[model samples]
Target: MQDLELQAVESALTDLVDGERRWATTTLEQRRDLLTRMRELTGAHAQEWVDTAVQIKGLDPNSPLVGEEWMSGPYVMAASLGVLADTLDHLAKGRSPLADVKFHDVRDRVAVNVLPTSVYDELLLSGFSAEVWLRRGVSRAAAKAEAGLAQLDPSRTAGIGVVLGAGNIMSIAPLDVLYELIAHNRVVVLKLNPITDPLLPVFSKVLAPLIEVGAVRIVTGGAEVGGALVQHDLVNHVHMTGSARTHDAIVWGVGDEAVERKRAGDPKLTKPVTSELGGVSPTIVIPGRWSNADLKFQAQHVATQRLHNGGYNCVASQALIISSDWDQKDRFLAEVRNAIAAAPERAAYYPGSDDRVASALESYPNAERLGPGGGRLLVDDVRPDSAEPILSGEYFSPVYGVVEIPGTGASFTAAAARTANEVFAGTLGVNIIAAPASVKELGAAFDDLVEDLHYGTIAINAWTGVGYLTPTASWGAYPGHTIDDVQSGIGVVHNAWLMDGIERTVVRGPFRPAPRSVIRGELALSPKPPWFVNNKTAATTGKRLTEFAADPRASRLPGIFASALRG
Candidate 1:
C-alpha cells in the first residue's frame, strides 16, 4: 500500500481541485448536472460498489454493513459534493412523504436520496400507523453556510479540511470529506488512517466518477502524514474521529514549539476546526414501569447501540445509565449481556479499545465476561465514581462495564445528563431509553434532555447510529459551535440536502425498533438477522431501497414494490 506513487496522485489532485472550484463558483444548473451524473454513476455502478466492499473492503458478503456502505458511502458522496445546492429557489415548496416512513425532500424542488428515509420508515414503522415524510428544502441551511461569506466580510476565513480517516469504518472518511468539501465549501485533503489504508483503492473506485470530475482526492500515510496535513498551507479546517490524545496533539501541536503555541491561546496559526471526537457516550433509562417486552426491548436497544461497529463508533453508548430503583435494571442488564454475546467480534478499529477496557476492569476488577464469538466484558455498578477517567482513555474492545446511579441522590436521567454534558472524549451521540410510563411522566424532561445534550444526534430508545444510516438525517457537530470549542467536528456530513440553517439534526424513532434491520452486530449469531424479513432477500431489498429513494414515483416503482412483496 505504501508503494503507491505519491507525486502522481498529488498532481492529479491539484488538477481535480481546479475542476471542482470551477464548478462550485459556476452556475447552479452546471453543479446540478454534475451531481445528476454522479447519481447516474452511483446507480449504474451499485453492484461494483458491493463487490468492492466484499472483496477489497473486508466486508462480510451477507452483512447489512456492505449494502449500507454502498449507499451512504460512495452513493452519498455524490449526493453531497457533486450536487452542491448552496442557493435556494424563491418560494421553495414540494410534496412531503408520510412521516412514519423515513422520507424527506432535502433539496430544492425535490431531492430523493440514493437511500431515502422511506427504507427506514417502512423497515422500522410498525402497527397500522401512517407516516408522512417531511417536505423541507435546503434554503435555510444553504443560506446559513453562505451567510457570513458576504463581500462585506473581506476576511471570509477559510480552513483546509483535514479529514483523519477512521481505520475501521470506510464511511467516516467520505463523510468527513463531504462536510469539508461541500457543506462548508472548503478544500479537503483526506488522510486515510493506517488501519483502513488497504481499502483506499476501493474507495477511490467508488469515488472514481467524482474523482474524475475533481470533487475529491485521497492521500495515504501514517501519523506523520496526518501531522503534515494539519500543517499544510491549504488545510484550515481540521476534523477527526479518533482518540482524544490525537485531538490534543492538534489542539496543542505536539513538540515544544507546538505546546508553546497552544499555551499562548494561539497556535503558530489557527483556522476553523470541528469534530465529533471519540468518547464514552451515555445511554440512559428513566425510572419507569413497563411491560416485560418493553423492558427487554429497551435494554437490547441500548446494548446494540454500544455493540454496533465493534464498539468503535464515536456515537456508541459507552455508559449505560440505569435508574437507581428501576428494579428492571437486572432484567435489562442480563438481556444486554445476551445481546453483546450475540454480536460478532468486529476488528477493533479504534487504536486502543483493548487498553480502555483493561483500565475499566482494573479500576473495578469485576467486569463481567460474555460472548460466544469474541472476547467481551460485562460489568455492573463497578464505579460510578471510580476516580478513573473514562473519557480520557481510548478503548478498542467490546466491553460494557456498568456504573450504578443511586435512585435517590439524582434521578438516572439527571445523572446521565450530567455525564453527557461533562464527559470527556468526543460528543457524537446519546440514546435516552425510558418506558412509556417514564415518557408520560417526564415528557418535558425528555425534551429538555434532547436540548441539553451536546451530542450530534439524540435518539430516544433507538440508537442514533441508525440515524446516520438514514440519509434523511444530518450527521455532524451540534449547532452554535465554533472551531475552538467544537464539542464535535465542524459542520454536517451525510446530509445530501446540505441544509444551510441546521447546526445539528435530532432524529427520533420509536421505543421498540421495527422488525426490519440491516445491522448484524448485536443480538444475532450469523450474519442473518431476524429483522431482515426474509434474510435471503437482503441484496434485493437493498437495491429496491436505493431505487425508491432515487425516484419514488418513477415507473421503476414497480420493481421496488415487487421486491418489497418478495421480501
Candidate 2:
C-alpha cells in the first residue's frame, strides 16, 4: 500500500465520480454523440492497437494472429461502440431497441434473436446465428420493457465504475468500459491489467474523446492500484473480467484468511460488483451416424475451440463429453488429436500458463502429449473413477480432457448435458455438437436438455467463444450462483440488445458450414481465421479483416482471400 500509488488512485476516483455525476444527467443525444466519437476513434487506432498486442504476445508482426489481436481488440470495441450508438440513436428517436426483437419458443423460455438486426449483419457474420434465452417465467414483453431504458433516461443512474480489465483479451477492458457507459450509464475508471499495460498509451489515444469529457479514465498498474481504486469512497461500482480466485480476493480478503472470510460471509467490499470470469467449459458430442467428412469437420471444430487462445480462454473446451458406445468415437477422438497436432504452436505468452500445463500433466502422468511442444496434453485415457484434475480445474493452457459416457443418441446427449451441468465446475459456457438427423430425432428431449443445462452460453455445433463475440449475446455464468460459491463469477456483458432476464445465449452453427460462409470450414471459407494456430498469414488477413470491418470495401475482399489462401 504505497501512499504515492494510493494517492494517485484516490485522485483519479474523485475526478471520475464528479464526471459521472454530470454524465448521469446527460441527455440521450449527448450520449449518442459520445459513443459515435468513440467508434470512429477506435476505428482510426485499430491497426496500432492490434500491433501492440501482437508484439507483446511475441507473435510474428505479419502473421494471421494479427487478426486474432484485431478482432479481440479494437474490432470488438468498435463494433460495441457502433451498436451502442445505434441503440442510443433509437432512444433519441423514441423507438425501443426491442421493437426489432424476434422470439422462438423453446422448451422453457423464448430464445430472442438479437443479432442480424440488418442486412449488414448478414454480410458481416453469415450463418453465425445468435440468440439470448431468458430464464423461465420471463416473457419477451417483459424483456422488451427493460431494454435500453437506462440509455433513454440516464438521470436515474450516476456513479464512478471501476473496471479491473482483463490481460488475456485486449477488447475485454474497452468492452467493459462501454458496458458501463452504455448499459449502466456509469462513468468509468478502467485499470489495465499489468500484462496489458503496454496498451495503455493506445487506449488513451483511442479513448481520448471520452477521457477529455471525463466520462472515461484509463490507468495502468498492478493489484495495489486496483485495491486502492476498489476501496475508494468515490467509486460507486466495480466490474472485473478475470478469475474467480481474483474475484474472491477482491470481495473478501487475500491469502488463507480470505478462504475463511468467504466461509464466514465477510466481504471486504459490498459495492455492486459484476464480473465475467473463467470457466472449465465442456463440449458434449451426441453420437449418431457420421461420415469421414463429418469426423474431419467436427474434429477441426473441437481443435479450434481448444487451441483458440492457446487454450488460454475461459470458454475453451477443457472437457470433451462423448459417448463410448458410438462406433466412430475413437476415430473422432483421433481426428481431434490429429487436428491439434497439425496446427502450428503458439507461444505460451500468458504468465503461469506453462506452470498450469505442467501441473495438469503431473497430475495425469499418462496423458498423451499432442503437437510439437510439450504444452498440449490430452487426458483421454484417464480412469473415470480417479481424481481427474482436467475436469475439476480450469487449466488456462493448451490442455484438453475427454470424458466418455456409456449411452448413445438422445440418452447420450441427456447424460452429457447432466454431466456438464453437475460434474464440470464452471457454468460459463458449454458446447453441443450433434448431427442434424440426431438433433431432429431427439426433438422435445433436445429442447429439454438445452433448458436443463446450467450454463450462461450454450453453442450447438459451435464454440461459445462465438457467442461471447456476438454483441447481442449475454456472456456470463448461469444464474442462481452465490458469491461464496461463484463458479464462473456473476452478471454479464457484450449484450447490445439490452434484453433483460437473460439466462443464456445459444449460438447455433452448421456442423460443417459451407466454405466462404460466416462460420469457418475446410472448403471455401475465404479467410483462414487467425485464431487457428496453423494459419501462416494470420496477421495480414487479420489486419485486412479489421480494416474491412471498420470500413467495408468489396475491393479489399480479394486481397484478404489471397492472404488467407497463402496460409
Candidate 3:
C-alpha cells in the first residue's frame, strides 16, 4: 500500500480509539439523545440523500420509480434511527425494549412480536406483522433479561471496528455502521464501496454528529483501503455486507493459499468477523384454488420480488418454487411473464450487471426475454435434480428460474422447504406465498412448515425485503454456519429490539390489498405497498413517510394515508 493510503487508514483508526472508550461508557440517555439528533439531521438531509442516489442510479428525478431511492435510502435509515432511539429510551427508563412486546410459545421456542409496537405502525403498515423467533431453549424470561445494552459489561472498553459497505443499496452501509455502534458497542470506520462513494458527502453531513465526536468515520476506496482498515491492530472486529466471495477472500486470504487455508481450517484474519453475504433466495408458491384476480396480483407481486431494483438486491427472489400439480400453474406463469413485460424500464446500474445478465443468457440459451429491450430473463421448468447453476448460485441481476416440486398441501410444502434448505446456495432469506384459505386449511401443518425452513428470515404471503425494511426484525442467515463454510456470513443487523438468542424472523402480510382484502374476510387496510415498482404515488408517499418517521406525529397521518391510498 502507498504511504499516503496507509497513513490515512492509521489516522482514521487512531481517531476512533478514544471515541470507542467514550461510547462504551455513555449512559443510555446520552445515547438516546444522540440518536434523536441524528434522526433530525436525517430528515433535514433526506431530500439530498435521495437525489444523490437517484442521480447515481441514472433515475429520472420526477418518475415515481425515484421513490425506490427515497424509501431505500432515507426512509429506511430514518426509521432505523427512530427505532434505535426508542430502544435506548426504554433502556434508560430501566425497562426491557421488549417490555410491551407480546411473546408466544411455538412448540419448544418463543416468538417475540417485534412489529405494531405503536399506533403509527398499526395505522401505516396495517396487516403487516413480524416476529423474532428465539433460538430453541430460550425461555421468555431469558429473552427479556437478555435484551438491550444491559448485557454488555460496563467496564470493558469497546474498540474500533471496520464495516465493509455494500454497493447496491444506499442505506446498507450507514445502517451497518449504526448497528456496530449501538448493537455491538463499537466505534466504526465505515469503508464505502466504490460504486456508492458518490454519496459520501451526503452521508458525511447526515452523520456529522457522530463524526464530530469521532464515534464514526466514513471512507471510500477499493479493496486495498478495506484491507488496510481490517488489518490495523486497533480494529477489534469486522462487519461486512457483500458477496460470499468477498467474505471468503477477507477471512481465508486469496488464490491457492486461501484454498489450502480453508482445508486446514486456518484463517488469515484472527479478529472476529460478521457478515450478511447474499445467496440465491427462493420464493415458494403453495398450490391453491385461486380466482383470476388472485393470480394476476400475485404474478405482479412475484415480478416485483424479482425485478425490484432491477434484481440487484441480496434478498431478491431468484428461484421460483411452485407445485406442479396446481391447475393454475401455467396460467400463473403466463401472468408473471405479462407482469414482467409490462413493468417500467430502468437501467441495470449496478457494476457488472450486463455481464451477469449475459452469463445467465449463456447458461439458459432459451431463456425468455420479457419487457422492453429484453433485459428481464425467465427460465421455466428448471429440473430439481439437474446440475443447474441457478439452483446454487446467486445471479444478482434481472434473472429468475422456476423449479417444480411434486404433490400439494403439506407434502408439497415440506418438499419445497427441503429443496430450498438443501438445494439453494445461501440461507439469507426465503418467501412463501400461500392463499389465506390454503394456510387456514393447513392449520398447524402450515406453522410447522414455516418452522422447518432454515433461512434467517421467512416471509409468508410477503417479500423478505419487507423484513429487511422493518427495523425491529433481525436480518441475517440462520445460525450454525462456521467461518470455513460461511454461507451468508454471520450475525444479525437491524434488530432494534436488541433481544438475544434469535434464530429467525417470520413476517406476514395480507394476501390481498385494501377493499379486496376486506371483501375476502381479511381486514388489512394497506394498499399497494409504497415499495412496489408500479406504485404511482410512491415518490410522494415515500417522502412523506420519511418525514413522519423522523418525527412521528398524528398530524402527518392524513397526508401519508392520502398519498398511499392513491398508490
C-alpha lDDT of all candidate models, in order: 0.54, 0.79, 0.88
lDDT of residue 14 for candidate 1: 64
Q: After superposition, how far is residue 272 of candidate 1 from its true place, in Å?
A: 3.0
Report the C-alpha lDDT of model 3 over 1-567, residue by residue, as the tens digit. Answer: 677777778888888987777766777788788888989989999999988888888888888988888788888899999988888888878788888789998778999988777888999999999999999999988888788853244335468889999988899999999888888888899999988888999999888888887789887778999998888889999999988888889999999989899888889988999999999899999899988999988898998888888889999999799999999999999999998888888888898888988999998999999898998899996877536888778889999899988899889988988898888888999999999999999988888789889999999888999889899999999998878889987999999888789999999999898978999999799999888888899999999999998888899999999999999
Candidate 3: pairs in clash: none
Residue range 342-439, candidate 2, lDDT tens digits: 76667889999989988987888888888886668888864333256777768888888888888976677678777887788789999999877788
Cα displacement (Å) at residue 160, model 3: 1.1
Worst 10 residues of 1 by lDDT: 90-99
On a 0 to 1 TM-score scale, where does candidate 3 land against the true structure? Answer: 0.98
Structural similarity to truth (TM-score) of each candidate: 0.76, 0.94, 0.98
Report RMSD (Å) for each prediction in the order shown.
7.1, 2.7, 1.3
TM-score (C-alpha, index-matched) for candidate 2? 0.94
Clashes of each: 36, 9, 0
Better of 1 and 2 by lDDT: 2
Across residues 264-383, which tens digit of lDDT does each residue of candidate 1 receive?
777543655566565666677776665676665555566566665566667766767676576777887777777777654344445666676677678657667677533677767645
